[model samples]
Target chain A: MLDAHLRLSSLAHLGLAARSIEEAGDAGIALGEVPRRVALTLRGDGEDAAFLDAVGRALGTAPPLTANTVASLEDVVILWLGPDEWLVNAPAAREDALQALRSALGDLHHAVADVTESRTVLRLSGASARDLLAQGCSLDFHPSVFQPGMCAGSHLALTHVTIHQIAEDPVYEIHVHRSFADYLWRWLEAASEPYGLAVVTG
Target chain B: MLLITCPWCGVREEHEFACGGEAHIVRPLDSHTLDDAEWADYVFMRRNPKGVQYERWVHNDGCRRWFNMARHTVSHEILAIYKVGEPKPEFEG
Candidate 1:
């Protein structure tokens, strides 16, 4: 249970946790967290025009049809999980978007869940970013197969994650559950040891 | 590592799938009407075929959908994969 008066911070001890690699250079690899992002899981019939229209109204864009693709509109990005399921992440708060979705999808046989606190995102970038991830990840990390603006669900070091390529410089975002944050961070650091890792904090 | 193809999520590593052993075993219409021998057959008998076999598999990690697969037990080769309610495909052993 959470304390009523005590403050709660998701990445509270991350600064201290990443102390060893503080002085590492930019040429190797830089790691950081994009904390406090809004995450909402949306599920509905993708073929239903009404459902698509409702989701568009809430997100300002329709969902992606091509599997593992992302429909990014301004601050909101919707990652397609399956034919009828998507994971929407936004930089801003999700109250307005959630309300809009509820009002739009009235009485539909669908599900919308807010999972902001369920997952934590870690940004991995630099020249050796892809090479570093290729150590333990099962999916092919070559830029030719996984290009910029593409996302995929894969297993990294025995943990499930959603990997998104945001830039051609090999900047990738890994979304993992909050419960596995510490373990994944340690695993990433261990995997990136040979290349030398630099921890970036805001 | 086996690479199983999910009907919805395409080809993914076999770690994402769970084998649901044997497929399409119909239960007796009325268990009370059957004698001990017939009841024992329905409960215990299984077609552990050596060549081509029909099996049920579920994509546990990806799409989480269940589907049927025709596989060669000896060689571990997948012949065909179809949906849950799909009819058993007609193929030579």
Candidate 2:
């Protein structure tokens, strides 16, 4: 039997030592990993009223229909991947939402897979967060083009990442697969080095 | 880089998509009945015109669905993109 206290982290190899630099300028950029978030890939027909109602009942909100947009109900944030597909991010400690989703969606022609263990959530926030990402990402990061609540899947540097704009200060949440976490972290650190990068871990 | 618009997802970067050769190439209904020349035409012959051409592309990184695209092979400009089973859009250019 696995020991309850023996916890393993996807980014454990990189270690949790926080690194920062003192500068006279604004908080240049802070990067950190979000721990213990339940991730699920939800697939269903968005046009079906029954399907939408069931999903809403499970997550306390309907799956967003807008392209590349996100719908949040408390701690759970549903990111629209496609017309009929969404990625649900919720608090990891709660299993009630997952159970509710399974029971409510059992009869529908839908799919719900727990992807919590497969993805690593990385948060980037600062005055230069947008500019830092703009260096590698091709998408237009201007406020007029990409605002809060919008999410997109695009290649950042050398790998694919899903970036979500969380706030006006340009706090961005990047979700990448566990295998690419280290590479992405190192790459991001180097990219933001000019702006004085800081690493924070929990 | 070309910006290919997915039928389901909106316009995304060219890297997210994978081009699947010529589009609208209907396979022979009965292959056994066809002669060698007809088989060769069906298998090898494709319209690789200089201007507007029809082709298939898949959004591999995003929605992961195959869709048809009408583009200019010379300029690499996407003229139109439509879903499967839908009629091809008229080529305006």
TM-score versus the correct structure, for each prediction: 0.87, 0.89
Restricting to chain A, the TM-score for each candidate equals 0.89, 0.92
lDDT (tens digit, per residue) of candidate 2 on A1-202? 1233664567777765534333324558888888868888999899999999999988899999988899997788999888888999998676567778999987898998878778888988888898899888877899999999999888899688899999987888999998898889889889998898777652
lDDT of every model, 2 decimals: 0.81, 0.84
Query: Model 1 over residues A8-118: C-alpha lDDT tens digits?
Result: 345566663556355447548888877567788899999999999888887899888888788989879998877788888987455567777888899987898878767
What are the clashing pairs of model 1?
none
What proportion of the real contacts between chains A and B does each prediction keep?
0.23, 0.50
Q: Model 1: runs farther than 4 Å from truth?
A: A1-11, A16-24, B26-45
**Residue A162 C-alpha lDDT in model 1:** 88
Model 1 chain A scores worst on lDDT over the 10 consecutive residues at A1-10
**RMSD each, Å:** 3.1, 3.0
True contacts kept of 1: 0.23
- DockQ, candidate no. 2: 0.57
Evaluated at residue A202, the lDDT of candidate 1 is 21
Question: Per-residue lDDT for B1-93 in model 1, tens only?
Answer: 778878887888888778898888889889899999999998888899888999999876566678999999888899999998899996677
